[model samples]
Target: MSRVIIRLLLTLLFLCPILAHSQLEDIDLKELVAGAQEWAEENLDTNVLDALPELDRQKAQKFLRDLQKQFQGEYVINLAALRETANTILPLLESHEETRPYAVWLRPRLDYLKIADEFLITIPPPKVEPGEPAKPIPNPGPIQQRAVWIKEVERRPWPPAASNHVARLKTVFIAEKVPPELVWLAEVESSFDARARSPVGAAGLFQLMPDTAKRFGLSLWPRDQRLQPEPSARASAQYLKLLYERFKDWRLALAAYNSGEGTVQKLLERRNARSFDDIAVYLPAETQMFVPKIEAVLLRREGIKLAGLVTPRD
Candidate 1:
């Protein structure tokens, strides 16, 4: 078995019970395995898959079953193992142009995995009562995560790609009547790599999803306009401006940007909440971390708080 297969198998074995207990009991495990196998066969390079020594079919099935779960799990601790897997897979993904976009997706997210690992090591778990039913260990809240990212982002030098792209991208955002400082969003989304693409179909420096790109008048066919820096930045700025108009707060607008507007809206209505912090805990773990990470990035790169950002006056 390839080391990737072995590691995934171990992770699936270790996390299956935890996953089953945590709201995923209704999922059909075999179906998930089949789906992953199908995706790998279709989308991944045949040569790359062949290079990974084959595992027994049953073992491969078992390992692949929870592969997505391991990456998307709500728990931060689960991410520690994936950091190694991502490191191993990155070079392989970069080896082929056909798969390089997936590498772009994974590269920016590696820091997230690293930070989650450090979060597990550095932050002590919450205390439980002696006789209380054990509960999932909660991830650090937005304020705590902001502090963590402040330290994490401060130590790193600016991404080299940012120097080449930020000026041009800022001009696009300004033309769209959005704050130029918000152009740093590309740093958080794609490290200013215009070629960046998410596995789920988001693309370009702004990482605009097809639906959002289309809604903003960008074309998906005859070439994905999302991969074009200027067009995508214009779309992104328009979307962000619309999100801000809906939410009225930069933090809430950003939370909507990451998690979807309906998600933030539903949570707000459900909780009778208006602020991001009020509904932050109920949001997906990724979005919970995302807004603060953006805030931290803005502060580090521009010396501006999220609240300090202002859309350009017409």
Candidate 2:
């Protein structure tokens, strides 16, 4: 009898709150979980079809499932975190489709990705001499001249404000010695357009991926901070700093930014190549084209004939 009473007490205690809440709010945990899962799966499938290779598709799909399992205990989906993971796999997404699917499930995540890209575009790493600065040499080798041209093309320009914004960026990119001209890279990248978005889902002035932005400390929460020019630029600078540190070459860093870091890393591993032109051939088609575009733009900006070439969009 005592045992039965204890069991009854336990049941009442457990049931009372649920009954009360059901009457007042009508919450359904199972329904909510099902809806979230369905939404996630549909979105994952779209990304898989649009951006992944067959082998990578399988891996990415499994990763998404793992995300679901990882978040099963939580009631709400942390879309920002999940989206970051997805953007890292974007290179895999390109072969399958020319553009991102604009479905509701995919749109928000892509928006976040764009914000990240913009942020990364703005901030680049500092340029540092690998060793103690040698006394100014009378002449660098042939390789040095080519490296200088490569640096000239990757430069980013300061925003409208020359002193303030430019100085701030220099601080974040402290890892390596940055060329002064390459500061314009961000300008050509998105015309300092914070809200800028690429067709393939790259976004902002820096045009960082969602994952890259988040990894570099930009928040893609309800609203992504990457769409803000100054902040995005700072983030982009930070990411570039990391890339330069890893590759120790400006051209390779730029190429890595435009294409998959993985692809560039693999190429570097396989070849004894040191020049951007050599490594560039192994990169994706878009990146090969990217270098020349940057070069042309820089040339135009510096030339007197094209004095009024770049005008801010209204």
Candidate 3:
């Protein structure tokens, strides 16, 4: 047999007798590790020391330190550190069958260390480098940036391509006893596309379906007046006003607009909810994201309005 295997056999032979005579929990764990290491190191130069590189020896040494930390007072396992150190050691040892057995023997001891930790709060591993890699900074995602950017855009004090239509709808919204700013709904609904027609038959700047347009006094007989910006904005605004009256919350009203009033109302009643967020979980995928989309656009419009008030810096 290879010298490493003979060494491992001798080490285990020594440890196995001690292990059998004493329960692992009852014995001093440090002694258990020290005894194993002392046996592994004894007569080192005379045995397989030439076959085992210094790097492998260093890994074993670190493992000894790790074992001390893991089984010492207030015993705890640093799982992440244990895993990382194991990664470093396993590859070096597993190339040879004799050394592989050491890893096999060590696995149970590693598991035993975890069993000893009293809580999630582990003893931090000794610092190996300057700063930890995973900490120090966090990066935002596109969706998060989209939400923030959209709100900041709303505060700009200038009108956009869609603003003229919003101005036209002011009288319409006022006539419907709704907030004029809500005309931004049309921009989100149809992108102010007066000729906008959905595959589902929703049309105009407001995206009102034929039946909805008919109820609001629009005609499709002569021509689909649902395609007219003026009348459609009036209809869209009136619908918003109607929804606000029913739900008594503008955000929920907007969610109703996106998800269908009946659907939203049922979710609210089923959930015993009064806020959009509470019922939002049950909303359709489009509606789930649509409300925030509208708010982003609305906030951008608000930004434009506010930006207009700021005097030129230069």
lDDT per model, in order?
Answer: 0.68, 0.46, 0.52
lDDT of 3 by residue, 75-105 (tens): 2223224655765665665565445534433
Name the top lDDT candidate: 1
For each candidate, C-alpha RMSD in Å? 8.6, 20.7, 27.6
Which residue segments of model 1 deviate by more than 4 Å? 1-73, 128-133
RMSD of 2: 20.7
Q: What is the lDDT of residue 226 in candidate 3?
A: 75
The order of the candidates by TM-score, greatest first, is: 1, 3, 2
**lDDT (Cα, 0-100) at 102 in candidate 3:** 42
lDDT of 1 by residue, 94-184 (tens): 7655456657766877877788788778778778899987676677777888898898898677888888878888888888888899988
Winner of 1 and 2 under TM-score: 1
Cα shift from native, residue 51, model 1 (Å)? 9.7
| Best prediction by TM-score | 1
Error of 1 at 18 (Å): 29
Clash pairs of candidate 1?
none
lDDT of 2 at 251: 65
For model 2 the local lDDT of residue 176 reads: 29
What TM-score would each prediction reach against the true structure? Answer: 0.78, 0.43, 0.48
